[model samples]
Target: MPNIFSSLKNAYQLFKHIDFNQLDALSKKVDLPKMVETISSLDEKQLSAMMKMMGGNTKKKELPPIEGDFYHLGDEALKDADRELQLKVRAVLEKDVKPLVNRYWNKAEFPFEIIPKLAELNICGLTYQGYGCPGKSNLMEGILAMEMARIDTSVSTFFGVQSGLAMGSIYLLGSEEQKQQWLPAMQQFKIIGAFGLTEPEVGSGAAGGLGTTAKRQGNKWIINGQKKWIGNAPFAEVTIIWARDLADDEVKGFLVKKENPGFVVEKMQDKMALRIVQNGLITLTNCEVDEEDRLQNANSFKDTAKVLKMTRAGVAWQAVGCARGAYEAALKYTQTRKQFGRPIASFQLIQNHLVEMLSNLTAMQTLCFRLSQLQDQGLLTDEHASLAKVFCSMRTRDVVSRAREVMGGNGILLEYDVARFVADAEAIYSYEGTKEINTLIVGRAITGFSAFV
Candidate 1:
């Protein structure tokens, strides 16, 4: 040992300059004396190169940044312009909404200041063909939903209520004159809208029966009932209220103007989740809506189902964003949060959790992407949308939990962002349709059995 590399004085000199700690650690893993003896046969040039390789004699190479968008679906799946629009939407959210999200969530207040900033993007009714809307693909619309919820699901819910549900109702069921009247302003965000399908007594079973009733008079309809968990209802200019028509006993849609004397909304308070959203308990004390305000073609529950069918895909996309927000946040946290003098991200156990999150996130994303594609192809079914909604929402809950697990105590704090995601995932899970209800929807389609009572 000493007679081998010890005879080569120059190679032995390099070893003397090397850090003893590094040598000791390396020696624990390898036979350093024999290794140095073997390398001692190399010439001066190889010896210098070998010394530099073993030590940081040269600059360390930089990696191309690891991020949670693990697959560049935003960059690769979209066309040049569409991809830019996606980035632009993300930029707006990060600049305007992200900074205020935790603060607003803490105060349980809505940020009205960003309405014009969001409106300036002209994304409302993006899939609708007229009324100053962009008339984009369903995929683009879903992408926009994802972009919104990735930052804040409350904003996503707000946007989807306006762009997808409320406007979608009028677009799919509104008459020509009705579309002319509301679609243009709503498309421009001049009139914010809320959808009132879920009542205090009914949510999953709203399709079969509605507590809200509309009695037709000579020229108007009187709407009387209460709506719960109606997002944006407190400030919505027009709320699309679903009511049971007294004469027909069929579910009908009515555009109830906020100015209507009998229409009142009390802001819901002390919600454990989605606090940034302004959920309202709406009271309609004989809310008089003109016959024209009633969705003319909306004669039955089927008409309402059309809007839900389309919006369900967007809800699934929202879940994808929720999971993604958590995954990305957790991954970034792991890379920076040092444990044992190294990044927790470098730890095998932490990385296992990160990969699991990404896998679930990716599965959700690809599933939603295809679901939207089916929508664009005119091949989307209730079951298809339901399947995605059920799967994404359920998986999102798991993803966010893992995300929180990785962050330790900071995961539950609202200021840290992951906590909000964990809270919001609960809303997305139960809303649109509960897991059991959506499962039954899919089950009915495949088995020809109605599982719901």
Candidate 2:
């Protein structure tokens, strides 16, 4: 009697999904009563299988948590306080900077509003020892740099120019008075700064081939010629301009104030990547700077290279951030976007792309970790930084490319965020140092041959 009742219940449940009209149509062609009896005689396993065939299950599928740090580098490697700082920086960037980036990027304008918010983090001049700077490890600074670029590379570049290049010029080579006057305010983002190393005609060759000239006249120096692609130059209070001196025919650093009548900066436009950064074309027409304002110890281009070498490692970390951002966005998108009645992430090709991106990103992160360690130990050289820069930037381009490919049509749209990452990756590949230039730097170090002409 119990078996009879269970069979009857299963038959009733099956009838719920059947259309009565369709059942009537089938009744004329076949025996409906006999078919029902056969179905009723079936046990629980058969009934459950039939329901599944009819698409009865409606439960939401569970997916893994979305995280770009697949290796737990942040969790296992950093100490308690350091991990807390990392999370703090990530929280600020995700909350304050992420939402505004796509809009400003579309407009090709800097969101001036976020400056005070970022300044509140007090992370500027992160590795510097004094002058209100945080005396942190190079690893910490590199990690924070990654945090910034993860959200927006333009924001990272803006901060790097202020903290690493411009302030570093003063901190490393400036007189005591210069460091006292500039580092504190710049560290707090009170006075924005710009670095003028790349010119309209000179970029990688600026080490020895600078075209801008500085001619001294007793207590003052006249800086002439134009500097191009100078980040923050349009509105920075001070710019650390590198010019060839007429006396020694070597590179010299000058503290050129924006208010000076001879100094002029025009905004550069029509950029496709890192558009939020206010890159400027600077024209120094006999710009006179006080002798005291000059970087006292920046005697040659080698001094300038010191700043670049230190900051290039940070650029490598920024590349990792850019790749990580794209990878995470793509991963989340694939898990949610449905195709052929299932998540796209379930497809083998899509998963392959994701794993490749993760592999490249992990490699970059580990290399940068060791690179920063070398820097902290004072064992870092030009070739070390350049190697990381070349490898990470190249891999970033590949990761973003695969990220966009996985998103298909949605990848190119700014609404998806991957589009911005795709465009910005190109800029990272070219800037700091071009891939060919950096490869040669490594090639020279390993082969003991100077390939530069």
Candidate 3:
């Protein structure tokens, strides 16, 4: 009777430690009932010994903090106010935007609900000097772009269209009245904006081959053409359209309002990347704009290139953010995902991939940092911005690819986040400038020979 009681007590202890789900699988090869019986028959001492052999430790080991800023740029470089702003944005993004991104990304829909919340941050036109702008340094603007893209590249692209490209055109080339009318409302997010430059057939050739035409009438300009892949076009209150002038054939910019009779925007669909952004196909059929709405100083493509140069540096920082997000997500996933009874991150090969991602991310971050500094010091050139964009965008693709690889099958899943980064990296690689075009820009500067025809 005492032996029976001892066996039952030992069985209870053994069952407490045994994983029955694993035992069920083991049953496929062995007699699980018999194995349980054998375990029950063991003495208390044997049960304890068996539990110890099974690694008796039930406590989960704490993982290292998930951080992608391995070089401490935020901590070591940013001033107190700048760092606070960065963290504030990061906290808001993780709390509000992060939760809804995957759902919206899957549906290929924009979350208009967050626009008000984002406006509350008052970060638009961050680098502009007046009209309620923040008047911050270019470095700060670059960091914020990184922060936004780190959470969602779609959001960053949306903001870039608003703050960088569209607003930048007016700020750099608009009349004082134009700035006064648009900058304040845009700074407050009361009015949304979009940039229209690339037409249906002209992309890299937009510098010299803009197909959109703007003919100056008695008191207005008539614009007729199609602008494709214009971010924020579908719902933007205003769009900055670049068109070739019929008189001089030089490219000029116009502020085309949404209510214009000839302006129409159709939402682009079935995009594989940056799906949260509502890219639009804008068709302007004899769109008439008052002479006042024409950008006063944007007389030629060279003036338009000024805006592109300024925004290209921000795009480089955006690549860093996308790569950093993917690397951090992959790093966190590997630390928790178990394989062969240990974390996959414990394996040397996985660590190697993680280190490679970090190396690329760090390099991109530092490069953009210097790029922003050059802009702040009035030393930024087309070649400087182009080199950073080319190198960082190319490296971002590699980092995101490795990030997905480290996550294994989960890398492609949107719920994992790395998959979105992987797709969005392709867009970043192509937009603002393509890899080949940017490479040629840098090559031209270095060799003093323009490869572009």
Candidate 2 at 430: error in angstroms?
1.2
lDDT of 1 by residue, 295-373 (tens): 9999999989999999999999999999999998888888788889887888999989988999999999989989988
**Residue 119, candidate 2: C-alpha displacement in angstroms:** 1.0
Best first by TM-score, ranked: 2, 3, 1
After superposing candidate 1, which stretches have Cα over 4 Å from the reference? 1-66
Q: Name the 10 consecutive residues with the lowest summed lDDT in model 1.
A: 56-65
Per-prediction TM-score to the true structure, in the order listed: 0.88, 0.94, 0.89
Which one wins on lDDT?
3
> For candidate 2, what is the lDDT?
0.92
Find the 10 residues in a row with the least total lDDT in model 2: 54-63
**Candidate 3 — what's its lDDT?**
0.92
What lDDT does candidate 3 reach at residue 194?
97
Runs of candidate 2 exceeding 4 Å displacement = 1-43
* Candidate lDDT (C-alpha), each: 0.90, 0.92, 0.92
TM-score of candidate 2 versus the correct structure, residues matched by position: 0.94
